[model samples]
Every structure is written in structure tokens, then in C-alpha cells.
Target: MDTQHDNALTHALAAIPGPVPPSGVLHVVIPHTSRFTVVGNHLAQHAELSLIAIGIAVYIQSLPTGTEVGIKALTARFPEGEVKIARALRELEAHGYLRRTRVRLTKGRVATRTVFCNQPGAVLRGAVVGAVPVVGPAVRSTTPAPTLVREHIHVPEPEPVAVPTAVPEEPRPVPEPVPVREAAHPPVRLPLRTAPTQPRRPLPHPRALTPELRQAASALLADLRRHAEELVLSEEAVEELVPGVAAWLERDATTDAIRRALTADLPKPLKHPARLLRHRLTALLPPPLPGIHDLAQPRRTPVTPFQTCDGCERAFRSHDPGHCRDCRAQYWEAA
Candidate 1:
């Protein structure tokens, strides 16, 4: 009845107009034997094995043998998430439609190979047993017959061969032993001595802040405190801020420019001055000057560095480093 129904469905599909083009269409062959086995299996009717799981199994079976099967590949071929494909593969394994065996490859590498079996578990097991020749052909041949037939068929026995006894012989004479030799001189011993230890010295302090650096730091702090009185910078905080500000000066940021950047659009009742100041100084820093090599032999076109434009905050490459071409032109126009 199922075969007739399948035949009718095939005919109905064939009668439809507009046959698919042969150029890009994929032909997947599903064996008639597999159709019955898969449809009639109890696992196929299971609620956990939904249509999605069945579809995934059929797709895997359709793939060429030894073809790579992975979550990423499945997701690309099927309109499903990686998680769903993984779950479907697990369901197929549970139902014995799929088996994954881990194999070690050359170069000490390992990979998993998926095995698709359309037959039921019991039939598969029986086929495996039948393929192996572990038991002798005689034993296998006898086990399939009835017990009475097996007993009656083994009546003939081979006659015992005549045995030969050994006679006693006379004893032989023993041989003499060889002599041993000793070393001529005795071994000598050496005396051991203890090594002396040296005293440890204290590490030197880091270089002190120069007077110019101190002035810049004081000016920066004064500007910050004036604009935002809520800011309370301890000596440690000042020490930390000094080096960074000094480095900015070395990079050509004037005292006034640094002051403007930190004080721009000050928030009333500032809650976190150190964090805010750190972000402004770091974000508004200018690009480093070109190196000596770059200046001496400039390329026809300089290799642009990756940085966020100060004006737009969008990442772009530019020879100017901090500003992209569009924003740089805008700045010059405004000036």
C-alpha cells in the first residue's frame, strides 16, 4: 500500500509542468528500501525526532561518503541555527541512524567521521557478526542446524596412532672454570669547599620630576580645579597625571591647548574628574611626528595609520593619524 502511494506521488510530481533545468539542480537519490525502513521505524515517529531532525538525517545521508559534516556546514546548507543542527545530529545518533567514530590521523592529529546507517540496530549488529570469521566455519555451520542433527552427524572418530618410548643414556664428564683479574690501582677522593655569600644592595629611586614638568602639572591641575571644584587630586594622582601631560607637551600640545581640551564642556558637579581628564587627554592627543626615516625618504604615498578621527570618532586610515582627509579639510576651512 505504501509502495502504491509512493508511486502515485511520483507520477503526480512528474505530471507537473516546467521540469527543472539540468544545469544547477542537485539530484539526491533516496533508496526505496531506505524509504520503508525510515518511515516504519519507531524512532522516526518519536516526538523528539521532528521533521527537522529527519530532514537533517536525509541530508547527511545524501552527502558523499567521507564528506565533511560540521555545524557550520550544516547551518550554511540548511536554514537553521548551529544549536538546532547540533541537537538534530544528537537525535540522529540516539536513534542509531548516525554514528560518529573518532579516528586518529597522520601527524598525531584526530578527527571524527560520521557514519550513516539506514538499517535498524538489530539488523546492523547481525550483519557485523556475520561479516567477522571469528568462529570457525565448522562451528558456524553446526550452530545453525538442530541439536539432534548436530549430535548424530559427529559419530565418526579417528584411531589413535602408535606411541614410541625413549631409552636411557650414560652421563657426560664436566668442564673446568676460568680465572678472574683485579684492578692495579685504587681510586682517589677529592675534598669539598663552601662558597662565600655577598651582601645585597637597595634599588635606586626613579628620576625626580623636572622643574618644567612640575610647572606644567601645576598649571593643568589649577585649570582642572578652577573649572571643576569637585575634583580633588591627591599627590599620587598628580604624580600620575604629570608624566602623561609632560609627554603630551613633548608631542607639541601647548599648555593652553591641553587646558582647553580638559576644560571643554565641563559638567556641573563633576563626580569623576580623574577619569574624565584622563579620557580627554588621551582622546584629544595629536599624532606623533614622522620618524627620521620617514622624513628622509618619504614614499610617494605614505602608509596611513589606523586611528579614530577626532572630529567624527569613526575609524579610518590617514597619513595625518588623528584626522581623516574629510575632517582635516573641514578643520582648515574653519580656521
Candidate 2:
């Protein structure tokens, strides 16, 4: 029975796989009493510090000694942006987990060094008591630590010697007062005056029109005013309609012709006069006939003049003189 048991044990040991070979990768050993461990626990239990602040503190503590821990570097390690990383660093500093001091370099330049503390502020203060503060960047060392140089120095007591007594000095007499002379000339005073007000000038009237055309325009406006409830014509609307009425008169259409065309075949209630007028004026106009002189001459295409834009200074083909389309849109927006 013992021999059978030994054979079974040997078979089980043979069936197991061999151990993995070392990859030569170096590893850092974190002791249980390290400041990083203590700070990490404190951060985990902290109620004031946010998750981002806690994570940033842990990342700073885990970095190798003397490593550059700038905002750019922190942003690259984490998914957050530079602003967020900077805010998190500030939060860490507020909680006494980190500090940064500007250090002067040997080459007449300046740099910032970040110091991380794992222990609380009280504990850290006690540890550095009676010792000069560390100035350079913090780094790990294999050699023994150096002794701290104290800031206070002891001085030897002076030898005891005999001294003579001092004498008191006499007081000086006061001088007589002198009167000051007045100025020969005095400043002159100027009288204040009120500004005169000017009367405001009246606005100029629109361009002059012929009596016949003006009478026709007025008759059309009066007809629309009579049906004001349906027309909804304000003073501005009447002014706008005068131009269209003048155009009809130039085509030899009488006021009576326009009134009949605009008011004929109307619905019981004229809900929209503007739409009806626009349609009649556009559709009822007779087709233009060619003039005798125009018919005799050869037809020629009108040439578009090149104009420079006031805003962009670029040349473009246009009949009207002003800014280009893009500049005009921008100007209207500003207005």
C-alpha cells in the first residue's frame, strides 16, 4: 500500500507545469511603514477631498524621487486635461498632501520642485525640528544620510574689563519767530457764462413730383384709407404705396384703371389688401412694346461696370456702387 501511494504522488508531481522564467524587469518594493501607504489610506477615508484630488495625490506619491511632476506631465499620464489636473493639484495642496516651491538653478535659471508629504502636518513639523530645512530636489540615495547643519550658532563670551562713567551734555537756547511776507500780485477771478441753445431744423421733404402724378398718388392713398380696416395702411405703408402708384401712372395707367384693377372681383371680406394689390399690379400690366428707334438699331448686351468694395477693397462686377455681398451682410448685422 505504501509503494502504491508513492507512485501516485510521483505521477501527480510530474503532471504539474514548470515555473516561469524571470523577465529581468526591475520592481520597486513599498514598505508597510512608507509615507505613501499612510497618505493613501488617509485620502481613501477623507470626506473633503474629491475622487480626482485623491487620485492625483496617490499618483504624485507613487512617482519616483526627483521625477518632474508638472501639469503637462500629469495630464499626459491621466485622461484629464491640464486645467483639471492643475485644479486637482491645488486641492491636494489645500489638504496638506503636496507643496511646490520655486528653486533657483546653478545656471542662473529658475525651476519648480514639488514636495510630497505622506504624514500629517503636525508629524512632519516635529520631524524637522532643530534641523535646517532641505533645499534641493528630493532624491533617493544608497549612501548614508548627511548630518543637518543648524541655523543657530554659539558665540564665545567676551572677556570682563573695567569701564569709565559718561558725562551729561548741556541744552541749546530757542530762536525768535520771523514773520512771512505776502505775495505782491493776487490771482484774478473769471466770470462763468451759460451756453446758448439752438433750435432744431425740420427734416427735408422727399423729391418733388409732377402735379398730375401727385394727384393720382393721393387719390390711390385716399381710396386705400377709406378701406383702412381691410387695408391696414399706416402712414409708412401709404408712403410705400405712392411709389408703386407713380410707376403705374408712368405706364399711362389712370388712377381709375388702378382702382378698378385692385378692387374688382373681391371676396366679401378683403382679408389681405397687400397681397391682392401686389398680384394685380404685377399680372395686369400690359406687355411693353419695342420703340421705333430701338427696333431700328442692333440689340446690344448691357455691360456691367467693375466696382471696388468699400469694406474688402476687392473688385467685383456690379451695377450699384457699394460693398460686396459678404461685407453688406456684415454691415447690416452691425446696424
Candidate 3:
């Protein structure tokens, strides 16, 4: 065994290169200054996680809170297709790095909620992330680690000396006392949160909406997905949002105008399609067209009534019935 160990060590020493060449991959790492996310090496270099899964995890971690992370949303955002993204998401979930749940909302609606863990193991152990490495591209280098050699030296032992029997002990001063902190209080119990008293926004009266306007509004809401895929609403959500869109139309808002208003400059990673439309509809509602009830009626000029001539029996404009202008002239001449 000793001979084998010596032979292996001699081979390793002889194989060490004297001149080190530059590696193909170089890291000019500049520490991130702002808007950065911390990822764990365990998850990044997972023994079982695929490359797609790691990339997906990093992307999700970098997003702001409450960002939509549905499989469809991710597939649309990334170059990967639906099947591959779905598979990667499942891989992440299997290894405890991702959690997906179907949350029941206040209404009878179910929403998909995604949660990401930067350090799954630490989370499982009920501890905070202490020393997880930041995310970076891993490069394999061909350079080998340098070997070290140590020299050994021996010296004679010296005779021990005996201690004096009557060595006097020195007195030590006590340290100043530190003020102790007060006793800790019991943890406060948080009160249960109640549902919102006013969840729905005030909408225009339903009676004001005509059948044609409702149909147009419903069609507009359903077609929003074409302009912005994130605005895709479920049937129930579309139904709930139709009235609000109808309110916009009741005020002389055209579908094109409303579409531009709702779809223009939409927020990134839209979490709630219905909620955003409801807000835009209510907030951007145009004032109803000028109606007689809304505006003062115009005053009409007084109009004179036509009268029949007494002598000529011809119709003429006068305060009372009289001869026609030609008949009046003739009558005047006769008088």
C-alpha cells in the first residue's frame, strides 16, 4: 500500500504543469450594485435539476413580488415552448424549490399562486439563508490545483522544573456589573383578518346599459387577450367585467377607444386580468353625451302666426287677419 501511495504521489508531482495558461472562460465579475437577486448553489447546481429548470428558477426569483408565474405566462415570456417550460416547472416543484397552489378567492374563483424558495433545504430546516452563493455562470477549468510540500524537524526534550511550594497568590479585582435587560413579554396574538367591506368598485346603473351596448362591451372584454395575452380573462371573470365595460360604452365610448384605454401601457406581469379592467373601465369612463337633462334647453325665438286676408282671402303675416299685401295696396288706393 505504501509503495502504491508513493508511486501515485510521484506521478501527480511529475504531471503538474510549471507554466499556467489562461483559461477559455474568464470571469470579470463586477458585484451587482442594485436590483439583484441571491440564489443558492445547492439549487443552482442541483444534481437532478435540468438547465431549463435552473434558468426558470433564477428568472422567477428576479421578478417582483405578486408577479404572475403561471406555466402559460412563463412559456410566453421565455423562448421555450409550453411543454418544456411545464416540465421544468414540475422539476422545480419536485425538488422543493417551487410550490404551486390553487387558491380560492373571495368569490367562487380559483387562482394559481406560485411560491419560490431560494434555499429549499434551509427552508425545510426552518432557518434563514446564511451563506448561499449568488447566481453566476459556472465554468469548468482544466487547470489543476497546486501541490504543497512540508519539511519535518526534531529536537531533544528538556528536563521539567519543579514549582516553588510557597508561591503567593495575587488578588484580582471584580469586573463592573452590566445592567441586565428586562424580561421578555409573551408573543402577541394577531387578530384574524376579515374580508374587505368594499371590494367592488361603484359602477354605472345597469338600467342605463342597452342590449347592444352590453353585447359590444362583452365582446370587447373577451377580445382583450388578442391585444395583450396577460389580459385573458376566464368566462366568469369576463362576465363580471362586462358591466364595467358597458358603463364605459354607455357614455359614448367606442370599442376602439376603450380598447386603447385598457390595453395601452399595461403593467408588466399582470396578476389579475379582471381587476385591472374593472379599474380602467371605472376610472376612464367618459362623461355621458350632452343630453337635454344634463344641459339647459335652448330658448326658442317667438314665431308670428299667419292670418287670412279679409278682402282678398289670401294668407299674409300679421297680428290679425287682413287683406294680402297686394290687396292691401289696392284697398288703400280705393280708400
Candidate 4:
């Protein structure tokens, strides 16, 4: 730093919103000032120094005297240095106080470095022209331009323009009228709305089963009937077992027929032993065949009979076995 510049910095620091005493003064009054002013200027008193200035001073004091310094090198002098210094330097650059450039060394090598100084006139002009001032009109123009003038001219009247007239339309000829004839018979009257014929409801019919599925189901029924006693199947069981058996039989060589057969009867559960047989049959089938019997039938609540219970002296609706639940329990206890 130049001695005269240092002296000027000390003077500016004194002018800051704080009290400045002589060099040997015991106490100095410090005032709140923006960080930029504190860091950029030097101080005469201890209170005049900002925390950042103190930190920078300590960093500079640590380096050897007369050492050539660059902005990055100066910023990195502290152990806790970070990219923030580069950012602050950028702000300083925007203010025209800092700059970066490459310089050729005496050893035929180039070195990149940052320099700090007051902004030049051209840079200041660019900034002032760029910024739209808040107070008063801006001092600079947006672009360079020369003053210009425009002129108007007067002329004498000349010849008048001619106007053309439109032609008239021609008259149209009249047409001859045709003769009319009367109707032979009087018009007939019909009722406003005719009654709609009711559509015939579909007739109640036996379940539709494909020929191949029916044959397979028949074969399964024959097998089940042969072993009915062992399986404990009744009439209801026969009805339920047929669809599942059809699906299982069609699972391999006749999957398409089985799919057609089982799609509507999906969700009817098989008995335990029959379910095991179905599983074995599924394992023997090829890939992409129709799924096994979906024994999951839509749940229906059993109809509850409305009855008066003699034991409980209450009317209740129930799907329970012959005796009401309470009576059944009491009878079992007495037994």
C-alpha cells in the first residue's frame, strides 16, 4: 500500500460515523457503519477497526513484508478462507475496485492474478448508463447518439379529380300461375299415441353348457358318483362339483372350452379332497391355460325365519338350526 493512500484511508475512517481520538487516546468511540466502508478503509483508533478489517490486518501481518500480493492470495491468507472472499471480490469487481487478469512472468510463463484499484472513467460510464437511478433523472444516456432535426414542406393545389356515375338495373318479367286440384277423399284421423307392445321376457331355460364341457362334466360326475360315499356328496354337492370338474378337465388339452365353461360360474369353492385333486391337475397343465376353479362365490345371507321363541318370550328372525340359540344352549346344558 502507498503511504499517501494509507493516510487518505485513515482520514476517511475518521470521517465515518464514529469518534476518532489522537494516536495515544485511551478510549475511542465506535459507530455502526456498513461492512464495506470498514473493510475498505484503514483506522487510526482501535474502535475504528471492523472485525473484518482486524481479520484482514492479522492475515496481512502474518505474511512477509514487501511480498507481491494478488487478491486470491490475500483472501486465502486466513486459515478459515472460503469461496465467499471470491464472491466479495466479485462484488468489488462490480464496483470497479477489483479485477482479474493474466500477466507474463520474466521466466516466459503466464500467471493469473487479481488486482484492486479505483474504477476507471470508462467503467464508471458503463455502470452509470446501465443503472436507472432512483432519485432525479439519470445522469447518462443508454446509448451514444448525435442530435438530429426534421423538416416539414408545403405545396400548391393542382387539378381536380373526375368522378364516374353508376348504371341503372333492368326490369324483370312476370310468370304464369298453375291450376290447383281438390282431394277426392276426406282426411282420416288417427289416435295421438299408439300403445307400445311389451317386449317378451327371456324364457327360463336349462343352463347352457358347451358340448365338450358337458361331456367332460359328465365324465367327472360319473367318477364322483362312483366315489360319492367316500366323498360324502349330495345333490347340491353334485351340482357344485360339476363346474369345478369341468374347469379342471379342460385345464390342459381343452383350456379354451374350460374357460368358456367356468367364466360364468367363477367363485364356487371345491371340497377339501377335490381341491387337492384340482391342485394336482393344475400342476400337470401347460402354461397360459385358464385359471383353476374360482370357488369364491358371491356371499348371500341365508334367509332368516321370523319366529316367536317360547323359552325367551321374544320374537326373533334367525337362520339358526331348528331351536333358537339360547334354547339350544340350555337344552345341551340340561342334557
Tell me each candidate's TM-score. Answer: 0.28, 0.30, 0.32, 0.20
Best by lDDT: 3
Question: What's model 3's TM-score?
Answer: 0.32
Superior by TM-score: candidate 3 or candidate 4: 3
Candidate 1 residue lDDT tens string, 56-110: 7656544544456777888988789997788778767666567677889999999
- What is the lDDT for 323 in model 3? 76
What clash pairs does model 1 have?
none
Clashing residue pairs, backbone N/CA/C < 3 A, model 2: none
TM-score of 1: 0.28
Order of quality (TM-score): 3, 2, 1, 4
lDDT tens readout by residue for model 2, 56-96 = 76665555555667888778888999877877777766666
RMSD of 4: 43.2
lDDT of 4 by residue, 8-125 (tens): 7777676656555567544334675432222223221323333443444433323333344444565666554555444444443443333567889997999765443321233344
Model 4, residue 6: what's the lDDT?
88
Residues forming the 10-long window of minimal summed lDDT in candidate 3 = 146-155
* Local accuracy of candidate 3 as per-residue lDDT tens digits, 1-335: 99999997777655655643566633334578666666668767866778998998888767655567787788789889998788888887777667777889987999776666665554333322132322222222232111110110111122355756886789667543333332322332334679768766675545567788778878888898898998988999877887888777777777889899999988888898778877887777787788776688778998888999888687778887767889878878999
- Estimate candidate 3's RMSD in Å: 24.6
> Model 3 misses residue 7 by how many Å?
47
Candidate 4: misplaced stretches above 4 Å? 1-72, 118-335
Model 3: how far is 31 from its true place, Å?
A: 1.5
Clash tally, candidates in order = 0, 0, 1, 6
